[model samples]
Target: MCCAHKNENRGAFIVLEGTDRSGKTLQCQKIYDYLISIGRKCIKTEFPNRSTDVGKLLDGYLRKTIKLAPEVSHLLFTANRWELNDYIEKNLQNGVDVVCDRYSFSGIAYSSGAINLDYEWCKSKEQGLVSPDLVIFLDINLSLSSSRSGFGDEIYENIKDQNNVYEVYQSFSNYSFWNNIDASQDPDVSLKNC
Candidate 1:
């Protein structure tokens, strides 16, 4: 059994979330490397992990070669997270900082964007999973983000889809523990704030 009270120095779980081209990937890497440089044990990972079976399905869905219902895709995304829950929990327990590029919030935003599902329905599936100690949201202007990195062939990479997801993210802004950071500045400045 896991002890409720453990060492005070247990590592923190940090999640970085943002729209595409919002610099979240770079920020996640920077944070992970910084933690390592400080002698903290850390592991960085991303959602739609693309390594597991469920992730493979998600990859296919994103690729558009295989069609899945919006709800089904949402469940798959949730299940992918479920697969990593234990690993994340154990790592934190062992004093390892787990840095995630994207997480449940991304799932909620992206899935809810694709389908008009209840926010409750989207959030309910993640209720008991370990929550991040910190969630840094790299908020970037939609047009700027899209301009930096043009839309890809992925299912949710278009302007319309991104707009919807952005709204969804805004809707849940109050319910979760998140820090919204303006990502329009230099990466160094962004990292300093985050």
Candidate 2:
């Protein structure tokens, strides 16, 4: 079994993680819609939520309007997620499935991959958070992801950083809860795999 800590009475916590433009958002929506249509309680959410106070800083950083040291930026990202912990946990406990577009995995992979931060330290910050019941990683090729529309609009959207992040994500494939889906496939096919 996966190392995820789950309560049998709680709804599943599912996370979809991948590089920018790797269709995480889309798949999240698809999964949520499917669940809802089938009479399941589900909500779709994304990390670096860009709505909270910390998320506002992260949004500014991502939009190139502000600059921060790599470590600080990474912490800000983690804090942003922390801001949502209560909401996520409460929903799960209420039997509402949570479909998150990204989570701690992205934070660690992006920070470690993009700026060469210590992977262990990056992982360490994620302690004491709700673990996903299932993590679906959309595995898209860097070249194809880079060529997608609006690819270079944000940080870590380039090929080199993405390649690094992809490698880091690959390293997590051995975990039983982690599912890797080929992002290059048709949306229907990919959704089916998910």
Candidate 3:
């Protein structure tokens, strides 16, 4: 992982990462809500934000409307993160906690796992991006995740690709700030553990 420039007074930057149907979106909202309920200043955001121009291309790629080579797609994903780095930095510097649905790790995981790209090269793309204070990875077996609602809706939602993605996520288990949660558990249980 790249060393990020952290501010002592900044709010925590937490990111949720997982394979398809792994409940990252739901967890991100729940985390944000919980933080707010406790009177914490928090905001929710997501990667491949699907709002900026680069993100629009990413959205198209995810939705199967646009096709890109693995290398190009990987760079685009990183560019999308770069597009929002200032926003994340600003909120954090202002002491607003950020609960982001995805981030650079997902970029590396998806690109390297699904497309067999070089892992180190994929990681290099994220070199200067802001690193999260915590990375909550919702871990679930491929069989279980594949059975979840809306499975296979996206291009990389196949069992084979997800299995590869799962392995890639597993490889991140050693990161000091990474936490693995059993996503197969009940939402409340997962949330409480988090």
Task: Return whichever of 2 and 3 wins on TM-score.
Answer: 2
Q: Report the lDDT tens digits of candidate 3 across residue range 4-31.
A: 6456778889999999888999999999
- lDDT for model 1, on a 0 to 1 scale? 0.84
The better candidate by lDDT, 1 or 3, is 3
Query: Any residue pairs clashing in model 2, and if so which?
Result: none
lDDT of 1 at 179: 82
Q: Which consecutive 10 residues in model 3 have the weakest lDDT in total?
A: 1-10
Q: List clashing residue pairs in candidate 1.
A: none
- For candidate 1, write residues 14-100 as lDDT tens digits: 988888778988999999999999999999989989999999999999898899987888899999999999998888989999999
lDDT of 3: 0.89
Alpha carbon lDDT of each predicted model: 0.84, 0.90, 0.89
Of 1 and 3, the candidate ranking higher by TM-score: 3
lDDT tens string, model 2, 1-194?
A: 23455567788899999988999988999999989999999988889899899999999899888999999999999999999999999999999999999999999999999989999999999998888889999988878878889998887778899888988998888888899999999977896875
Alpha-carbon runs more than 4 Å astray in model 1: 1-7
Off by over 4 Å in 2: 1-6
Q: What's the lDDT for residue 109 in model 1?
A: 87
For each candidate, how many residue pairs have backbone atoms clashing (under 3 Å)? Answer: 0, 0, 0
